[model samples]
Target chain A: MPHTVNCQIDHLSVNIQPGATILEAARSIHIQIPTLCYHSDLCVAGNCRLCMVEQVGADRLLPACATPVTEGMEILTNSQKVRHARKVMLELLMSEHRSDCTHCYKNGRCELQNLASEYLVQDGRFIDLVPFKNYTIDDLSPSIIKDDAKCIRCQRCVRTCAEIQAVSALAVAHKGAEMKISTFFDLPMAEVVCTNCGQCVTHCPTGALVEKNYIDAVWQAMDDDARHVVVQTAPAVRIALGEALGLEPGQIVTGKMVAALRRLGFDSVLDTDFSADLTIIEEGHELLQRLREVIRDKNPQVKLPMTTSCSPGWIKFLEHLYPDLLPHLSTAKSPQQMFGALAKTYYARRIGMDAKNMVSVSVMPCTAKKFEAARPEMCASGFRDVDYVLTTRELAMMIRQAGIDFLSLPDDEFDSIMGQSSGAGVIFGATGGVMEAALRTVYEVVTGREVPFDGLNIVPVRGLEQVKEAALTISSPLPEWGFLDGVTLKTCVVHGLAGAREVMKKVADGSCDYHFIEIMACPGGCLGGGGQPMPVSDHVREMRARAIYRDDAGKAIRKSHENPDVVKLYEDFLKEPLGHLSHQLLHTHYVARKRY
Target chain B: MNGLRELVSALAQKHGTRRESLLPILQGIQAHEHYLSDDAMVEVARALDLSTAQVYGTATFYSFLVTRPQGRHVIRLCRTITCVMHGKNQLLKELETLLKVRVGETTADGLFTLLETNCLGQCHQGPAILIDDEPYTRLTPERIRVIVAEYQQKAALESENSGLINS
Candidate 1:
């Protein structure tokens, strides 16, 4: 059934879809309405009166952004009266806002900049500069740069941080025009538990929030001859790195990227996918052991629900939002951590080199990895395993600085032992890839049969949806295995901190009970990480997501339990999943932070 | 002895509920508790399928909510950029003199606990102070004593009434 929404605009007929908003309809028909305190992604705050439009026979003009298109609604978007009101609103906002965009990082890309250009406001008629009496610029957080001078109080970054990523890292502290964003305390960003996911940066229309790029740090590492620098690339980095090279979003440049890294003086170029497979090996066994405990004991006291701990952003969210469920999180170090720990220990030792001589660097699509590397417990090899973390964009900058042609480089291969990876490892770049990878192994281990689905593509858990859930039944007859039939395996996957928060609330409240859950702190998984290329688009997310799938399809081994190298690591070195060595190296605990 | 809770309870009783309802009747107990404790929140939840967890979740999630009991004199300092630019440091120095405690520490008298908040949403106030739930704009060290005295006087008056009611 097609529902027509009639928006009567000065006696002219306008038709819209059932759920289309008046602001959206006005936009489609090229209606010019001024808005100062309204953003498309943010919730309708209705604080600024910029987008106020006059409705026929009404005493007051309604906010176009907040007002939905209703039948028989007559709106005058561009009347002289509306324009006057909008101009006054903009003038008032300008009086309060710091007009320093010329030297600001968000100079050309600012929404306020575009609006000022459209409004053609030469000067502020009002001088209502509210001076803040007390405050300091908190530069504690490692990955985000916050400048409150240019804040418009739109609350877009706050909402993006809280609602989109479920971090609640930023919030409106005071009331009225005096309202400003803040963390737990007036602590520096570095001191706070911000995952630095950069979703806030992407959502922020101004330069108030930006990434803390480590391009200079990487350059220093490369320049040092005594430091044997090794760089490993995450799967999602290749797809979005081109954006930093002035290529269109979603342009694939894997070959060019490797060549560029080589030119940048990395002694050994490795792949993070290799360690991703290593994670699968350890994590997959952990899941199998948990399943065995469930089957053998038949006790509800057993921790049935084991959540995936691949994403540091998700891990921090759980700590803050749902601290009680910390034990449920798999104690496996993330693939990046595993790679770093091994690069300093196993790789360095195998190559007959000292750990101090090797400078391990990771090119990731995640900002959380930066914070993760800094954790006091992550120094597994008695040193900061990863010395420096570079975003995909930062790597592109390095390539550009090297004067290397990024678009025409030859394809290259990673180094021998740590370079080998499987399709399961590559899929870890996407949201549900971790869940699917774990399932391929656990399903086979428990049932002792091949995965019924071809390609092991668990369709139910796939895609860029905010939350994905699926329930599967463990097949019949394992009397020798002491397992029961028709055991429903309920699993839920949440991507984006906001969506993860929603599911977390249910879990925290003991509602929507599920046996397993997967959470990624960034939207669209690692492909949309804070470390990904700037000015991320839907096209880039799609391309990177596709690249992950392609990498998965190209590999011969698609299951973590099937990786012979991983099997050998456990057999020879680690001994078992919950072994003393595995726990020592791979697992760690979390402490509940006091917000007060 | 302190009379803040008793005063609030008497105020609530005068309005139409028991003194126990003062936490809810006053500016929600969240302002005093950091987050509403299970016992306190359950009392609020009894009226509404709202389990203890639901109430706890809301109380814990929001920054404004105080789930734990706060000190007698709660000083919420705005440490965000707006306040910083407005000489918040001077105000903090004054607060330290008045309370004899640093930010994030409670006074020896147990009368005040100084806390630095992200933003008070009072950016227009520049440096602002929230003494309990009431916000004072454009604050300075000189103005702290007067604000404290005003609240203290009211608390004293309320305590006299609480004694009469109990008697």
Candidate 2:
């Protein structure tokens, strides 16, 4: 057993592990020390010295985040000296920070603003206004915006991009107070190899970085007399939107969200889950076709270990980092794009309205969805399939702006036809949900039996693990898929971009011998996207995952092929999966990007 | 690749291509190229198995290493407290007049580049400046003209030698 170290914090003697920091040891005993740069999910940065504490017999105070707990250590977390020093630090931070909080995107959600109010640091009149560099705010990217004037040099976004995502689009270009977060040569994010996963925005403490707001355009579409605005919600939005609107983390408020959208003047409220089911049908057949070519025909041209293309961030990652292997990616568009295409083409045609008159909008937990929708190739409906993309935070702001009491609103149902979805669709919010959903349908279609996992859950692929691998043996394959009979269908799931890097490296070396791979760019998949609620932690992500899985389990229909609306869509409009019409509306291509 | 890039590639080959060799490799590139180019940084990143942004980050953090193209001669004027107290601004003005270029700008002919340094670590020297790693201490206005003429004569000699080789 490891030896426990005894330490005292604010006169309370506690035993903590040796590796624990002063902040962790204090928190272990319920002594809450304030912090700005210390995040529960990221490595200790220690740049923001808000957690300064006085040590007995030591002349200088120590930062609790970078300092480890030792035996017989006596630290005063709330002494006058420590409090004064923290106040001084806050004053210094505010001196350089742009305090236009009322107009800022992170108005009520900013951590620095909260700490300033908590410490009552109104002024540092002793110091004059310091000279600082004036930088231009970069709002060119469709997904995220950067305001250098508001950055406090926390490096949370920098660490998240480099350490977690392995993209490293942002870095510290210069040193000292002149130091600022920038891309290579300070290029705009739109020109960089940014996946726009938004983990940076999720962990940012201030309004320096945030998702591009589309509330105004969405509201303008609602006000347009010539247009009938329809909104679609992603699977992850329902679970996490509650937290932005002051509800608990795990609260499933799908119905309330639809009701609020209706009140905001959207003509119809639909669920992207319906199209998520559609994606499975198209992507599953695509996977099976590739498998036949590779295993049965023994075609060397077809790339094995085909990766899922549901995540736009992962798609962009491949375009920049591994463009040569783009053939290995499935040609299916994401559920958001698939829903947009159908909303304008299939649903609008059935309703006897012009596709141009119907406005298809998306409410997503991802920032990358904005960029994905803006791609010129997403015009399968002869118009821009997705007119506007609103983030989960933007949707909450709309609800609040319309004066709708979100929590107390009556639970409402989505519109019929295009709104119907299966349990497989609802689980698309979590990490391995797509793989599980695909296997649920694929295995049943082949063997005429449920997946061997307990309660239809593919347990091996369903966790917060960075990389998950599983294999399934096709004991009794369908007549058409006899080539796969007796052959083990190996699969893997990679959640974060960092994990995807490792998997891609293995694929390149021909070492990882998996047949199918699912890649989700965000840490906990779509639930931990760059556009989620503030103060996100592992526990927050876990709560979102639990709610997504619960929503899935509660659905009566759990398979994509079993969805009644999807079957009717094939009968009335689509005709068949991956047919001429489906390919035109449901698939897209990617171009290689410069890696600078 | 250009001659400077070839020189950097040779330098990396000489000093084993490893992560720790990044600083020395960057220094070698700057020494030959007078600045670090993006292509050199990318090549170094690939050689060291690191990211290009990370390589650019380290190269930009140091004050001595320039990322943009510099002149044939780099003139650094120390603006430390001691220098400022002892008439450093006058020497800066004199150098600007003699070179016909302001601070942080290169001459039209690309012969001289001027910069303001933090300190020369010779604080007691009062006012000082360094030209291409050579220090000129306790300067006067007359000394500025003499330093410029000396560098100009050396540059002219180098051009004559290159012209002879080309012919």
Candidate 3:
């Protein structure tokens, strides 16, 4: 058992764990201490001194976020001296910050602005240093925009990139007053090894980093009479879009979101979950073909342990860091791209509308999807496959702009022909959902039985573990797939690029053997994506994951192959999985990139 | 570029490739090449398994580690209070005129570069200037002229010897 330490904070006695920081102890007792640099997901930086508290009998005030709790320690959290120090710290931070709050994109949501308002730091006690510093704005990347003038130099983005993602695309570049987070050689983010993950954008406490929104472009597309605007919502957006509005985390707002989109003048309200089901069909068959080639034909050149390619961030990461292992990645396009390609060709032909007159838009819980849509190779439909990609936050902004009362809005169903999905598609928001979905179909195809689990849950690989592994022994397989029928198919599931890096290292060193691997760049899969709601933590991620599973459990159809619309799609158009048309539209290739 | 890669590899071999050895490796490169070129920093970053921005950040934190090209001879005039009080401006003007280049600039022939630095611990001997790590104290216009001429002569002689060897 861990030792306990007793401490008195503002005359409230509490017993906390020995290693807990003073900030944690205060939070346990509901004593809210304002902090600027402190985040629940990052390490203690202690640079921002806004959390300084007065310790009895100590000459200097201790930073509450960095100092540990001690036995019988008397701490005054909101004393006169502490309050003065915090106020002065807020004033100094505002002096350096560009205080054009109304013009900023994150005016009300910015942490520094909120603290300044709370402390009543309206008086200009210090000179504004923003005008003097040579701050530059880098808006070159399609995914993220970085404004140095609004930065507080908290290093939260730097830590998020390095610790969680293992991609140190951003780093502290200089010292003292000149110190700022910069890319390699201060190059533009698009030219460097950055994956455009947008984790940095979500972690930034100020307006320094943010997603490049396409709200105006979407609005213009909708307003144009010549263009038919069709929007598809990703599965993850439904679980977390409510958080940006007034609803709590884990609220399912799918029907409400569809209603708001319809009200906002979208020509057709579709679902990316439909394409997610299509992906499982194609990817599952591809996996089975590889298994047959390796096991039955004894092929040496064919790569085993194929990794999923649904995440654009993970795709870019592999292209940069592990370029030699490019063959291991599956060639199937992401669900959004699949939907985009189909919207222009298959959906356009069915609706009797010219392909050129249709505009494809997607609402995703990711920023990298913007970069993915803009790739040179994504124009497979003879035009730009996806004209615009909006994050979940941007969709909420559009809803508010349209004056739609999303909270009390009536629930509505998605439009037909391309809007239907299954429970497997709904669970794609969580970490291990893809692997679980694939097994549910593949096992039934091979053994002609449901997955050997209670209610087809696949419990072992369902939660937020960094890396999970599972194996199943094939028995009594159908005659076509019976290659001894005793092989134990091995699989691995990993979320967050750091865990993916570890698994890739093992794959690189030829140490591990697995048939399939699922990798997502952001933590907790797409539900905790970089473009999700702000103030993301492990608790919020867990709530979102629970909501995804709940949605999956409540669905009538629980398997992707059983999704009726997908069955109709294959029968009417594509003919079969990995057919010629599927290869041309639903699959793509990757390019190797420089490591630096 | 290949030579720079080899030099960085040699430095890494001697100093080890840990993060703490970054400073010594960078200093070694600057000591040999007279400046930390972009290619040199890139090589060091590769050797130490660090990002190029991190290497550039460390290289730029110190005033002594030059990140740009420099001439064969660098003249660092002290810009401290005591040196300024004791006619350092006149010394600077004399050097600029003699080298035909302003402060922080190299000459046309790339023979001399002039720059200003913080105190060199020679306040007692005011108006001190360091020429390629060699200090000259109590400078004047005539003294600055003689010192620059000596450096010019040394360069000429060394180039002549190299020319003879090539022939």
Candidate 4:
């Protein structure tokens, strides 16, 4: 009935908005409540009762995460009863969990391990039930590994797959103690419709789900004298890699990252941004050609509203859920894949190294890139385009393994050839960045001038909105492109698979009219990727996005076509955009897959 | 595959194609197919516009909605506290011996499947076993043998009638 509810947490009075949960009220007062199933990205599941708090005169302790605050409610977040209950809950979770923490990939970063240490939970408090249960570890997927033994039954991954991604690839199967997160008929993740997006891995509280690490393989390649290991870092990795290495979010660490990669024995440290510019050239040309075919040629076969295919997760999502709409996807390869293809072919020749001896590796802020690199069709250069893929977190682990003090490293530049990029490529890390980058180039190509936006910043398509839209009316076009001087280009930018699904539904039913759409599978684009730093929230994504835009604004060349390396790439090796060589290496097709 | 699609579509149409319709559609399929096959679940998911895994999860959550190959007649024996207290174990052993199978196994002839389920809301009639849709309550080991024999005889008679019709 009132706009505010008054509550006392730990004898401290706090006034919070009505309909606020007890957890929210406590948070407003800075009273920390430890939680497991309660993730910032998902709805309250309330299955894990670790956040229980004592209520005055109540017979049972209330789950703080699920219980709403009432006026005059008195709660104790860390009373003796609450502490004992929390400890017991931790003990129970540990009893069922495989507590071999030293060998776990998430040993130091596991939330459950952190809570157990904070609560001083000793071993042997309860009998270990892991040996009795037939737990399985599914490592078939190239991007992720799911271990049922370590799962705390928190249902975070299930909720993430359903709530955030809108792809119910994971669900709770069976009931009672037999209940577990399972795919259809408990199929291996590789065989199912899993997008290989590691949002579940990032959301999991324990080491139940994690990216399939290729640290050892990359190290082996680096160590082999016969092999020349080349590493390309994605634009998103530069902003978020700092978070995993103890630097604050929004800290630009591109120079430090290149320096660390060099110190880690990479023969050449390259930038995926170089290939990102190349993608812009290729994808921009593809969009113009499609537009020409549709609008000027009056071709009915050309699909309008061509979608960006830079995100492997979004590509797979379209393949599985909207196979009929595959025709609308752009044929340009992603930056990582483009870099890999050139590294094995053109770059290998320029550097006087055999393609077979070069091991192309990519450091990305996505788990899906691992699966992308392993795609059979990715080997356009007569070899696996990318030999191994490492997430931002994995690169951090390698940096730590090599004993490199990442924070104290001196700034360094990438190798000369295939290492230069522009501001447009760097902004590809954030949501709507691809759209912004494309508009900056496409408008210039069409009108022979910069975009009409102030300071080349497309404000409408650059935010955390679920679906962002912007319209630019083209006028005074170049004579060659003068089909009509007054054609308005409608573009939509969306991040997160859920938002992508909504946009795609409109595209499928012909409900909305748009010329181009940029879709990223992860929330906040690649900066909030499933393979980025853990503990990702809107605040973290916002900070990383700020860093991306700031990095873009500071660069001398703000357009993709202005990148000198890209211009040289076309001049020396590839004659033109969408030319014969470019088509052979820079473009790919999609496959329709079973939904199940 | 086409028939399954048609059946799921028909069920979806009857129940109204919404999230709530998933359960009734699955029930309708299980009613005819005895258990949900992979193909059947995929068809249901397609008709309902849901993921196959979500359908499988829902099907496996309920004991009655089986998700594997099942016999023509399913026998669900209550294994709750009341039924256990009322000598349900002895009745189970008698049934297993007569049927020549384990607790979760089906008969060699594929006529009957025996499974243990939680309370069937027949606590008043403890030691109850459900065969097909019928409930036989207050069962002893001797009563279980007789009930199984009656079903076996009925199956044999039906087979004989079918054989004659085919000839």
Please report the candidate that would top lDDT against the real structure.
4
Q: lDDT value for candidate 3?
A: 0.91
Candidate 3 CAPRI classification by DockQ = medium
lDDT of 1 by residue, A396-438 (tens): 7678678888777787767766776778887787888888877
Find the candidate with the highest DockQ and give its number: 4
Candidate 4 lDDT at A274 equals 95
lDDT of 3 by residue, A345-388 (tens): 88898889899999999999999999999999998899899999
DockQ scores of the candidates = 0.07, 0.71, 0.61, 0.90
What ranking emerges by DockQ with the best candidate at the front? 4, 2, 3, 1
In the range B1-167, model 3's lDDT, one tens digit per residue, is: 99999999999999999999999999899889999998998899889877676787788778778888999788999999999998999999888888889989999999888999899999998899998889999988898899888888988999999999999
Per-residue error for A476 in candidate 1, Å, reads 6.6
Q: Judged by TM-score, which candidate is best?
A: 4
TM-score sort, best first = 4, 3, 2, 1
lDDT of 2 by residue, B33-75 (tens): 8889888887787677667777888899999888999999999
lDDT of 3 at A26: 96
Which residue ranges in model 2 land beyond 4 Å of their true spot? A126-132, B1-8, B84-87, B124-126
Better of 3 and 4 by lDDT: 4
**Each predicted model: what fraction of the native A–B Cα contacts (within 8 Å) does it retain?**
0.00, 0.63, 0.54, 0.90
lDDT by residue (A1-596, candidate 4, tens digit) is 88899989999999999889999999988889999999878899998899999999897999999999999999999889999999999999899999999999999999999999999998888999999999999999999999999999999999999888999999999998899999999999999999998999999999999999999999999999999999999999999998999988999999999999999999989999999999999999999999999989999999999999999999999999999999999999999999999999999999999999999999999999999999999999999999999999999999999999998999999998899999999999999999999999999999999999999999999889899999999999999889847999999999999999999999999999999999999999999998999899999999999999999999999999999999999999999999999989999999999987
lDDT of 1 at A578: 65
**How do the residues A280-332 of candidate 2 rate in per-residue lDDT, one tens digit apiece?**
99998888888889988999999988899989999999999888889999999
